[model samples]
Target: MRPQTTLRRLAEMKAARDPIVMVTAYDYPTARIAERAEVDMVLVGDSGAQVVLGHDSTVSVTVDEMLVLAAAVRRGVRSAFVVCDVPFGSTEVSDEQAVATAVRFVKGAGADAVKLEGGGAQRLSRIRAIVAAGIPVVGHVGLTPQTAVALGGMRAQGRTTESADRFVREALAVQEAGASAIVIEAVPAEVVDVVLPQLHVPVIGIGAGPADGQVLVLHDLLGITEGKTAVFVKRFAAVGDAMLAGVTAYAAEVRSGAFPAAEHGYPASADAIAAAAAAAAAAAALEPGQIAD
Candidate 1:
């Protein structure tokens, strides 16, 4: 079996200029697929809210829901690092509350690390507290979806000079606050290039552009997501279409009675068949009034 990926290994990969691969997985099957692909990291992202739980946004998922998803992913992951996203309300209350939530992910879901969004004062405090509690953290910055409305709705961040500076500041702050790694999303590649040298930890980009590593949602990459996806998402496979075709074929066969052919039947002894025939004849010979509806 392959050995598990550790924070040290991640840092070494970054230092060696080896491109890391990260992907979001919600459950066992997705985790197993990710493991089989030999990806470097598996994130049980709050993106599950939209991709798996049918939630309209990431804000609707709870810590309990996240734990269930994380644990399921954990069961199937053998080598890649598993990081669980702390949902919106899970860490907003206080530093202690954030630590408690992080502990739950580690103890309840076997998460190697917990990811928290943003790098505001409160977010920094939470990251510090969680790290102080001996839990590894993966920080997220640039277009945090939990507060997308406050960010002027699901748009790219760091596009303006002021926003770009803030984005850089927060990215550094999270690292200083003891995050082992950071995920930058929906920011300009130039801005990311500027900050890359300043950051010592592994940087994983989604829509943010070239970094030490890249992460994409598993469902989006596999074409399991319906409707439009983010601009950065590149569908690598048409699994959704394949699923539809398989189910359609099954339905058609069932309708035409082409399924469950003679080969599908169980063998019966001659005596059993004879007994069934006798029973059918006796029932048919009953008077119309005697046969119950």
Candidate 2:
């Protein structure tokens, strides 16, 4: 109902009636489209590692690469709060190192905020430190791709009573650590159902539903892959299919010498064209001495 600050607006939307609609957009064009469509948040997610770089998981992306995409997304997005992910291995060192990496999103890539995995684990101190350094933090809880190796492969989390309770506690810990929002991913629906009302900060869900907000990997939503779409994702348009069809048609036309007809080329009055060409040649041949000084 009121004018919203970038990430703070997530808090407002959570407070108000409408649930925030967020999405992951790794590049400039996708960011521009999402911003124009009035998405509340746009994340330059390292899921680009999977979709763009052809990595099997998000593990291969680096902070520097994410920063590059984040800066480009920042330049493209005008309205939505743009959040960038801190990639795998970027924060393994220390708090100061985390703050330094976070600074690249601000000073280098121009992101409004940064998202990182873990809440009370190795990431808690770093989350606080980054916030203390005046950087907004988005805490990622429940399931983190950066820990794919440790997680023993991709699987849904919080099936057990203890794991569910731990997930809720970690969500609170992240909120306590000064995260403006928490990205709730790959957790049980019931767990999210309970935590959503309890969290003071906004919750952006991936697999979890009807949270304070929701986020989907853009590639999944765009139908960019013929392989598989995540269960939680919905395809809003068939952009990938249409683009491939269009490209294939163009290639066929080029191969068959059916494109570029005369009508598609230079169409001008012969006398005017001759005059223009002559004038262009005369201008090119002229020297300082031949000019009217």
Per-model lDDT: 0.95, 0.83
Candidate closest to the true structure, highest lDDT: 1
For residue 110, give model 2's deviation from the true position in Å. 1.0
Q: After superposition, how far is residue 139 of candidate 2 from its true place, in Å?
A: 0.6
**What C-alpha RMSD separates each model from the true structure?**
3.1, 4.6
lDDT by residue for model 2 over 128-172, one digit each (tens)? 999999999999988888885665556677788877888889999
Candidate 1 off by > 4 Å: 271-293
User: What residue pairs clash in candidate 2, if any at all?
Assistant: none
lDDT of 1 by residue, 132-240 (tens): 9999999999999998898899999999988899999999999999999999999999999999999999999999888999999999999999999999999999999
Whole-model lDDT, model 2: 0.83
TM-score for all models, in order of appearance: 0.93, 0.88
